[model samples]
Target: MLYDLFLKPYEGYSTLFIVLEAIAAFFGIVSVWFARRNSIWVYPTGIISTVLYVYVLFVSGVYGDAVINIYYTAMSLYGWYVWLNVKGEGQALPITWLHRRSALFTGGFTLANFALFYIILQYYTDSIVPTLDAITTALAFSAMYLMARKKVESWAFWIACDVISVGLYIYKGLGVTALQYLIFLILAISAHFEWVRLYREQQAAQAHPGNTTTKPA
Candidate 1:
């Protein structure tokens, strides 16, 4: 049973996939670690992971995931530049919450993307789990966009996406990637709290601008 749950999936796959997935997972963890610290290294490391996954997911026949990885790669580059310019001297980009209007737009966009992808994947491709794939892909799109903007709510989307992805990847017989998502879920939860703390600190600093001792950024 254990073999079936784990090793059985690797039976016909190339050793290249195992190696690629492991490397991607390692860099993915590193990227999240940098993100938690609000470091600029996050985008570089994330680009590596997402680039590899683009190939992996494409070969695995998960087209939605493949496309999202491509999007991630592009976003990582954009984010790298944004983060570099957004920070002032001795400060990181301020973590922020989404406005209600922005939140509504994001939510609507995710749903629309999901619906469109579901229809395309279901009708145009031979994808095994089109609905789940579409759902995860849509969530990831919103999460990645928010993360690039240094929004605290991005972690919430990531936490949700990571949890669903664990089951999704496992069902797709990619146990290693599934385990990676499990780790991602934990990191996303930790990041959520950390970002919230940072946001609070930033808020307090703004309220007490005269206090030079408060290191909000």
Candidate 2:
């Protein structure tokens, strides 16, 4: 069972897929690490991972995932620019919480995308596990958008999506990808707390204008 879940990909799946997925997963880890640190490298690393996943998922016939990867790539580019320009005290984009109105919009948009993708995958294609695929893809869309905007709530969406995706990838027989999501789940949880701390520090700094020691950015 251990071998099947971990090592079997090299034998059961195509060598190309194993290699590509591994590469994508590696950079994905890196991207998340950079994101946790609020580093600018996150977008570049994320772009590479998403672009590779687009090809990987498309060839594997997970069209919903492929489409999301494409969306991720575009968002990564936009995020790169956004992060570059939005300067705080030290030229870093300030971390922020989502506004109430933005939160409602995000919720609605996520549900709408889930429904749209579910219908498309169910009717237009012979996609296996279309409902789960649509769900994970939609959550991912929301998470990516929030992250691009540097919202602290993005980690919550990521944590939820990563947990669901662990089961989804396992069900699809992509064991390595399942493992990646498990790691992502852990990272997202940690990132949530870390970002919350950062947000609080930023808030404190804003309240105390003379405190030069706490640079939340």
Q: Clashes per prediction?
A: 0, 0
Clashing pairs in 1: none
Overall local distance difference test of candidate 1: 0.87
Which pairs, if any, clash in model 2? none
Estimate the lDDT of model 2: 0.85
Question: Candidate 1, residues 1-217: lDDT per residue as tens digits?
Answer: 6688679988888998879988998999899988887778898899999999998889889899998999999999988877766345555566799999999999999999999999999999999999989999999999999998989989988998898899999898888889889999999999999989877877888899763322122
TM-score list, all predictions: 0.93, 0.92
Q: Which segments of model 1 are wrong by more than 4 Å?
A: 210-217
